[model samples]
Target: MDFIPEALNKKPEVLLIYTQRMIRGRTFEMIENLGILTLAAQLNANGFEAKAYTGITTDAVKTIKNMKDRLFAVCFYCDFDNQSAVAAIISYLKKHYHFYVVLGGPQTLHMTEKDLGSFQADGILKGEGEETLLTWLNAKIRGEAVLVPGEIQPAQNADYIYLEDFSKYALPRNEDVLDYHERPLLSVITARGCPYRCAFCFEGGNSKNLRMRTAKDVLDEIEARLKRSQRPRYLFFCDDTFTTNPVRLRKILSGVKRLREKYDFVWFCEGHPGFLVKHLEFIREMIDSGMVRMQIGMESGVDDVLKAYGKQASPEDIKKVVEICYAAGLPQLTGNYIIGGAFETAETLATTTRKALELLDLAPGMLDLSTTFIMPLPGTQIYNQPEKFGIVLEDRECLTNLEDFPVNHTKELSLPEVCMGRSRFITAVSNKMKEQYEHGLITKERIQADFKLAFNYGIAAGYLKFIYGKNNLMVEYYKKLIDYQGLLKEWHELSEQEKNTWVIQRIPDFSLFDINTLSQLEIDILAGAGSDTIGETAEKLSLSAEKIGVLLKGLSDRYFVLFSPFI
Candidate 1:
């Protein structure tokens, strides 16, 4: 259904706020602004004046207050980097603004109505918020009692609350409300939910039920995005597994090719080894269709560690998949490795480290090492059996911030050993990979830079091992910086032919934006384009000279458009 923007009389005022890391921070390179923007579009279509307020500082909120009169406010809270900032906003809205504040997202889904009351939210939209939020808002527009589907119907006597399917309703124009500031990338969600069970995981721990969109449905979304967005340059498929079924993956790859021929975009998504080997041909097709990268969840290379985490695939399975991806020209692949999970001992951790080294040497892409500590979430099996895992249940305060606690402790290894091992492995493998790449051991520069990042990352890993153990900011920072550096080096080194081998390399992911937030420009220089004159690009894009000047200045600062020649 086409969403018509209703005026003040016809529509109810709806304000959507996204104060999470996606809008505010630079630590994570994400695609979707979670589901907040998508829910906002749904509200807008249902005769609600929806506007997204992101990374709103105190001054920014004051300015927004002056701009729009509010009726209801919605905030998506997913354990954001800045919870205090978002909590303050929520507090302000309820106490001063007198707005009906609805908190939705992963954090809300984890907490019951009582647990979420601490956030001071009037109501929490559990599960998928699209239908529930829209229903609640539409009812509010008519001055009806706000009741969310499967919402723990506020009652005197209730044993348990059953969640409802909010996905069945007409999804909002997520593409419409998605304000990219005319950036190069477009966020694409091909499917929802995962099929695996990883005990430490909080996102998919709630359920292992995989739900996919029809190939046609996904292709339609791509086509719509190609027409509506900035040429559909880059797509980040938010699906947990993009290659679960070979036949479906093949069909989607075929569709992606059809779209790529016209729109010319690249995409990336997460996958597992079990799916990759079964769909080798589709993997190749994915590469041909501009699928540049795969974020494979190779939690641990040790067979024992794999079994402990309920990862069905073994080290051999991962090796085979990584090798296949390399052959298919999917050169930028990253693996997620968990360090401090239940049943993880010092010896098992060492085996994981050694396994990572072995895999890094054999694989072709960049390997991202994630060393996450296991945390008991609300619905996961680990939460029910804390004693079985040797976790101290009495220490509730430790569990409050997952970053500070080690949820799983085994007798074989001290907490520090498990944590330090993760740091050591992340550092060692990363630096070794990069050092080999820098020394011309790898033919692909992108692959080389990916490894090169590990060198700098090792320094951070060393620090993490000393200070904050696993999943520390220093470790993460090292990984990100190394990745960025590697990306830049790859961007500079890859030839047009080599670059064309993968979809990600064909199109640029980063963009040039002005300080005023009024303008955004494609900073990606076309093949053979000289850096002699910035004015030429301004003319090509039909942009004003002033705008072009601003863009060039920004690009230069960001090192996107460099003046230096290759030695």
Candidate 2:
């Protein structure tokens, strides 16, 4: 450890700020920011006073003023959505404070040296912030700064700051890092870096070396968090590929299974498509181990487009993997799709939409389609050499809007054109939703309920499953229909004639559920539910209020009925 002057302080002090451009107006749970917490953990283990806060949740300058300890540096973790907002905060802090200001995160990984000046921060560390950040901080304190005074540089192997023993730094003291007052989910990154090389991914070019923590270590962290009264009902594995290594994933999940028997929580994780096809059988073990949701990187469903993106699977294989998972009792599957690939064209777009729509037909509420236009971040292969990927950077600064940028990941179609194509795709999906509604898949009450709430039913389903068991079929039912934003907009466009209470009876398709499995009273409840609320059914059928409420709730849980607005 290096010596510091007594005038500065007895110990080096630093402040980590996790600032976001969004989340100010929205109701959200406080999340455990793993990136900043890990760095804070490293600082604390070595003798440094570190504090952190979200700029949106609390004021940055006020945090500085209220701190009892003096500070040497202030670091801001940036999200891609809030790049401009974070930059503004950095400039304001620089004007108001004397400490060194630095920015690091996913957004920084995409910026080059020329772009660093635009941020206006004192220094920007251009890679993973662990070892590089510590060395940069320690050297600055020792008056032997790594770069020429106030100069920003890219991270290189010669920095000699990598954490060789990753296990020591993997866990952080939650109190020192984040507040989990209302947040019921804890994000755990069991590993760092991705192995596959997908051209459009930032991890492909930036995060090179993959490091992992053992299964025992992960279970220990969960137990510790549980003891702290921050009982997380869900665990989101925030790794680039949580299911990359078969052996490691098995051990980790086995431990997770044991923990779930006591604490009771399900989890969500993202994986490469190749991995899913390779371990088709193991998916059951994943589901049985309390994995409710699986997100696959299915950027494009067309085989040709997938090939161009360097993804390993074909269109058939993509379809095959999802079919396998759904067959193995996986309740929900989310496939990510991008409209404007480097090789995107009208034909390929049609095929991709058709593929997604077909899967939606097969899985109904069990499948979620996450569709969007591709963002060409600076360090990506597409951004570095635009012509090579059929992209045109009309104005790189206009990144906040998809339509205003003028280029949409490909020179073949302008950004607005891409937006229009995405709009049409959404309209098509909305039509599919209407089709499902017409097919007796859902009750009129659910349709009325969704339209009223702007269709935000997916989030509630997960929490509902905690109260109702994972086996409850209704909680696994309809996600806020695919393209919910577009669906909301479509509702706004609807004339009074199109909007509801203009009800055609959403008579339950009795063939969909097994009547034999239901009891005589439960069967009578469904028969009485037509065009009538549960209250009305109870009165007309002369059923007791308690019997009606219990039976109705049970039916709703089993997917035989919906008790949305009408009831």
TM-score of candidate 2 versus the correct structure, residues matched by position:
0.72
Worst 10 residues of 1 by lDDT: 500-509
lDDT of 2 at 360: 70
Q: What lDDT is reached at residue 336 by model 1?
A: 71
Clashes of each: 3, 1
Candidate 2 lDDT tens digits, 1-567: 222344266667788887654445332225567778778878877777776566563455567666523667788887565677677776776676667777777766556566566787767776566666777788877778466322355452122123445665646656665342434466788877767667777676556577777777877887776667444366778786788788888998898899888885677788677777878877888988988777887888677777766787777777777888767766667777887776777776788789888877765445656566666665667667667766666655545653222345565676677777787777776677557644656433433333322222223332122322233233233332223333321222334433332111122477556789989887776676546654566667788766765665556544565333332
RMSD in angstroms between candidate 2 and the native structure over all alpha carbons: 10.7
Model 1 spans > 4 angstroms off: 1-10, 21-29, 53-68, 78-89, 156-180, 390-408, 444-567
lDDT of 1 by residue, 385-485 (tens): 76565443434323344354464566566666766776787687767665654455555344333333234221122212332234233233333445555
Top-scoring candidate (TM-score): 2
Best by lDDT: 2
Q: How far does residue 362 in candidate 2 sit from its true spot (Å)?
A: 1.1
Off by over 4 Å in 2: 1-13, 23-31, 55-71, 78-84, 106-123, 135-164, 178-182, 397-409, 442-567
